[model samples]
Target: GRPYRSHLRPACDACRRRKSRCTTTESSDACLMCQVHGSQCVFVDSDQSRRRKVPTPHGRASSYTESGGSNVDHDDTSISMAYSGETHTHNALSDGQSHHHGPAVLVDPGRPHASAITGSTEEASMSAMLAESGDSNTHIISPAIVDDNEELDSYLSSNPAVGIRRITRTSSTSTNIGPSSRRVLFNTVLKKPLGIHARQSLAASKLEVIEKLLEPHGTVLIDLHTSFRRTYSEHKDRLSPALLSNLYANAMTYWNNSPQLRSCHPPDHRFIWVQANEALHSELFLSPGISTVISIILNVHGRPSTSMFGNGGMVGTAVALSNSLGLNRDCSAWDISPGEKALRSRIWSIVVLMDRWTSLAYGTPLLIHRAQYDVPVPSKEQLAQPNASIAQYAGLSIFLAMLTLTDVLSHYLENVYCISRTSPIDRPPTSSFHLETLLTDWEDSLEDDIRRLVIRGNDLDRAGSGNLRLSYLAVKLLLRRILCDTTNATTENEGAVQARLQTQRVAEEIVLLVQELSHSHLRGFWMPSNGFTLTSATLFLLRDALKTTNRTRNTSLKLAKDMMSSLQTHRVNDSWDLADDCLSNCTDMTDRIEAGRTFESPGMIESQYFIDNNSLMFNDPVLGFASAFDFDLENFQWNETT
Candidate 1:
């Protein structure tokens, strides 16, 4: 008789176990119940051999094939043959035979748990179990183990039941150093952020670690800045894009954020925690806290909010704040709230420096007004008025201030690299590539810093001194210095001389004010981290010597050049050779450079070399006028006829 047919059918695994029809589609690989539960699919065959029929011990069981072998075996006989064990289990269940392995349904109880299985077969088992679990089970199974080859393996142990399931789950959605050697190294010592305190502690620890990492780089940055400034001053066009970019990037980071200018961090012993969104903590693992903090400053200071404030006008707030604090009136630094006062002040100083940098770089009225010198334009009174929102603009203003920091840094490198050949303290020569290099690099850095400020204004206005802006500005300040011309303009006309002197005086005033601001507010002392003050002081001294009336413009210029040349040409083994050149060159070149001149004495170079390498050119014209005079030519010709 024909059996009653129901509209619904059993699940794939159940059908495979029962050796009956499974209505599930191939794509789903499971019946409706299994599909609802994310299960595996299986089909069955009618053939007696595919049914896992127990054979009669004495002979072939003829009745098992009573349905007819050729007619019962469906085209998909392979599928049923694959699940023959399930068929056997189903047969036993239908026969009411109790099985021992575990809770027995239609599927085989002896089959290993899906969790205990592995490979593709395990996947299949898991799918089958999922199917059998019915439609109600919706818990996402977290694979509790990770791949042995992955970095997570060091921290996450292997799981027998879950195999690498845990690892698979974790790897699905994660943003950090990859699960490789770096991850392993990180996991060895660090723990994941579990709560607020734990995360903050981790963040603080990472910051400290980053600070240490950046210490040596800070020194390198100082040296590079000095070298770049000197080189750029003399050889502006000779600079390379890559080198410029590298120097600029580094300088921008320092100018905007230094340890002295950044936020105060709690000690490692104190409880700490970081929010998950702040994934940047891991980046500090490699960079160090100081570097990271500086990076944040550069980012902030390099881009100020253009919405609330006009272009570089953001610096007005910093100046106002500095003035209010009764610090250096030049807006070198400012103190705000207790927690972030130091960092805020540092950022303000950077902003001021950046404003100058932009003036030099873009050469725009917003920054640079006239061809000869930049006009010190103050902002409108309304903008200087402080409010909570204004504080945010303070952050934005810092970013806008150093947009060209990178370029300035490059210029600084150019100068440093060129003058580095001379004694450290020697006055830089006009034709020695130092002047052009400094101008070009500083100009380029200022341009870029300003552009970034314009673009990042919104971000700065919202988050005062966010990592992005802070990093940008810090790099700029890390690479700043003043370049003074040793050749002062000399004029016999009283009006002309007074005019020149007045201009020089103004320039000197500006320079001195800058220095004073640097020393008092920015703490530009000769510490290992702040050794750039030496270079600044040397330039100021040169400016003073140039302003003197005892020497002609050309004579003092020649002296300055001779001093630098002697320092480079002679071998001096003194710690202060560079400083010595700055002093002796002023005296020697002013007195003598021509043969038979009163300042000349036999072997003057050798005599000075004995005193110090920088003083080797004490009275030698050849030191400064190598190109001016030609001893080899029988008929020497001066291009600029005297």
Candidate 2:
């Protein structure tokens, strides 16, 4: 077999490096190594190449033809560098052109030109080889192409090569359109705008900012407090005295309507059905000072729109005096430091008013008629019930009035004892709402006030002497203690000490008042003249006082034993029962219907501000009756007198 030599074109450089076959087809780009690696396969430039000097349309020459050559320069093998700024021109040939080359111009390699080259051809042979190679690969892709297909000129405007050539002739009549359109196309793809996506992300970020502004404590506290203030002011002036009388019932309306705050209670007629001390969620009123201010406002102005007490004086007084003494802060009276002068005064002020109201409400008897006003009589069944009406709150009002008085008096006494211990005041004492001055002023007004309360209590007794006696007894004991003598005989250093001593003395006097009430003769059977009796309650009071008072343990014990003895004697005699039935019936009728519970044991008179309800018994002896025949001492059963 003869070797086929002259017709075999030079091998591509890429095929030599990979040790793979080279087709040796002239101007074809594909070689075995480029095909296997899937890399770009292109013609390599050498000294003998005719394609080495192709002109670049732009400023730089094409790397494909940068070197001008004719001889095979095999030894000048410096590694070829890629052109930094370069471009190349490719021919756009029309179909059926006849720039003839041997063997159908075998450029149809199906892949890009291989980089493999061995420079052995002369310059003339290289040109001939390119002609054959270019002719073989050229094809008429679409003969019926329209001129409008060059619309890519608008999209890739600077790259002229990207414009369609239309292939008018199939063979060698091709034009090399400029290469700028490819650059234009690349820039268009790389620098695309993204305005819409950015705007959406920004909008979402703004919404998050707004949500955060509404989340903190500053916003919620401001809104809620403002609402409460607005509500309070709007209704305040509109409340009338008559309306104020039922403020408790009215305040319940506000609590019911607000759903968030409403879960704290069941739907009920009363905002607080249980007693004040028993309220489960009263802490919802969170302000420490709000209750005190409300009390003061009610005390001076009749009632706050939100009050439960129709009249405000007593509640206000209690809050003001208690806050002043710091009693409201601590439930246990014993917790206060004995050395706290201000506290002692406030406490004693409460004690004074409590005592004064008791004396006026309970110590005096009710008159049946104004004509017989100075004279006392048992009020008819209609007039004696406790708290007959809001007007009767005046007895309770007197207790409230004493708050400031007791406060100042206790303070002055402390100071007076402190100063008087060494020397009498070089200056005369001045008056400034002190307890003594209050007592003096009250005394000036007392006759009228006492007359009024007595008339009112009588009016209540006339209504029904239900728990009136209990209220009366409490007020009497309270007032009697206040009237116990206080002296300036003590020196200045002893003023505070004396006030304390005086307070103890007052408590002792109160105990005495209770004992006296217990021993007071019962007009019918064992029904006391006071119209009600609570011998057990008196003992209870003594026991409670022992827990709170600073009195010696022995003294409290002795007093307690004495009260217990009295209770035992009274209960054992069987006479207390004679009055039990009548008292019990009166209590049931009065307590349920009474607007304000004022019934009390004589010992509670020292706390006139309370709405205390004491247990009671009526004066009907069913035990001795033996089927109703042996009783009825008033009517004399069977016309017989025991």
lDDT of 1: 0.28
Model 1 Cα lDDT, one tens digit per residue, 1-642 = 322334344234344433444455567544664444322344333342246655433222233223222111111110010111122121110101111222212234466432333344422221222111110111111112223324444563322111111221122212243332211100010111211011122333343443353454433333324312334444333322222222333342233234432343322211111221122333233212212222322322321111213323433433432322222221111111121222223333443454443332222222211232221222222122223244334434443333333334433433333434457565334442554465345435443544454334233222222222323322222222222222323334564544444433432322232222211122111111111122222232343343344432433234344444443332142222223423443444333333212353435533432433344322321122100000001111111111
**lDDT for predicted candidate 2 compared with the true structure:** 0.27
Of the candidates shown, which would achieve the greatest TM-score relative to the real structure?
1
Lowest-scoring 10 consecutive residues by lDDT in candidate 1?
625-634
lDDT of 2 by residue, 145-190 (tens): 3222243324422321221111111111112322322111001010
Model 1 deviation from native, Cα RMSD in Å: 28.8
Candidate 1 stretches greater than 4 Å from native: 1-388, 399-510, 514-531, 534-610, 613-642
